[model samples]
Target: MNFDASLWLIFILIGLATTLPRASFIVLGSRVALPLVLQRALRYAPAAALAAIVAPDVLVAGGQVEILNPKLAAAGVAVATASLWRNPWLPFIAGMGALHAVRYLSGS
Candidate 1:
């Protein structure tokens, strides 16, 4: 199959649109003092993004809501482990362990 230049330009434009904000922030640095309220709001960005990605997967499976699923349980354990241990790696291990344990028990 042949790729078209217009398609490449479209892809580049899409990528640039996504990247510009972050790149601009890094370049501008502290010169751009975001408002106090905005700064506070930004503090929740990571959790919000994490929830956006994870909430649906954990809450819905096979077109059914399964809030008590192992994957979600594992994620919670991972978050707790991370927070308590104050170590980055332990959370990953804990999450993986929890997920695998769930899957193993469920035979899925």
Candidate 2:
């Protein structure tokens, strides 16, 4: 196939790849069900996903693992805020605030 056709094919494949899995449950209806333990375990999927995304940026600074960094310190503060208050927004606000405060203080 030509370049344009190849791109279109790839795009369609990606669209189907993402769409099919998500639509499967609805398509399959209630006939199929996950195990109880698996269902319960999926509840933490979002948090686990978020951590998987954020942990790298927070832990790695200057392309290396550093014990002290604004991001790391901010993450700590954010975790503390999350544990203290159940409010979801509080942790985000606290984290960003801590990040900026530490960056400013440390002249980073």
Candidate 3:
């Protein structure tokens, strides 16, 4: 109920909440199995999580939507480069090249 006691309690709860989900597989071992559908869907979790993180940065600028943004075009170029070739570095290089090219041309 006191300030220090409540703070410590909240910290402990937060730590437990964070640790439980990550540690569940190890603690439960093979005894518990996720469903087949869930297992299949989990394969895209990393890509989904990545998109969730990268999307806002790519699509937004100046805290607002700008259709002509260099980053937006760079993202499109990167996606296209990724689709056209299997090399991982091509997309990065293409995206960065497009970004710099647009920035230089637009003088922005």
Q: TM-scores across all candidates?
A: 0.64, 0.65, 0.67
lDDT of 1 by residue, 43-70 (tens): 9988999889988887787889888788
Candidate 1: residue pairs that collide: none
Q: Worst ten-residue run, lDDT, model 1?
A: 21-30
Best by lDDT: 3
Q: Stretches of candidate 2 above 4 Å error?
A: 1-19, 31-48
lDDT of 2: 0.91
Choose the strongest candidate by TM-score: 3
lDDT of each: 0.86, 0.91, 0.92
Residues 9-108 of candidate 3 have per-residue lDDT tens digits of 9999999988998898999999999899998998998899899988999888999978889999999999999999999899999999999999999998
TM-score comparison, 2 vs 3, better candidate: 3
Sort the candidates on TM-score, descending order.
Answer: 3, 2, 1
Show where candidate 3 strays beyond 4 Å.
Answer: 1-29
Which regions in candidate 1 have their CA more than 4 angstroms from the true location?
A: 1-19, 25-44
Candidate 2 local lDDT, residue 75 = 93
lDDT of 1 at 105: 92
Q: How close is candidate 2 to the true structure, as a TM-score?
A: 0.65
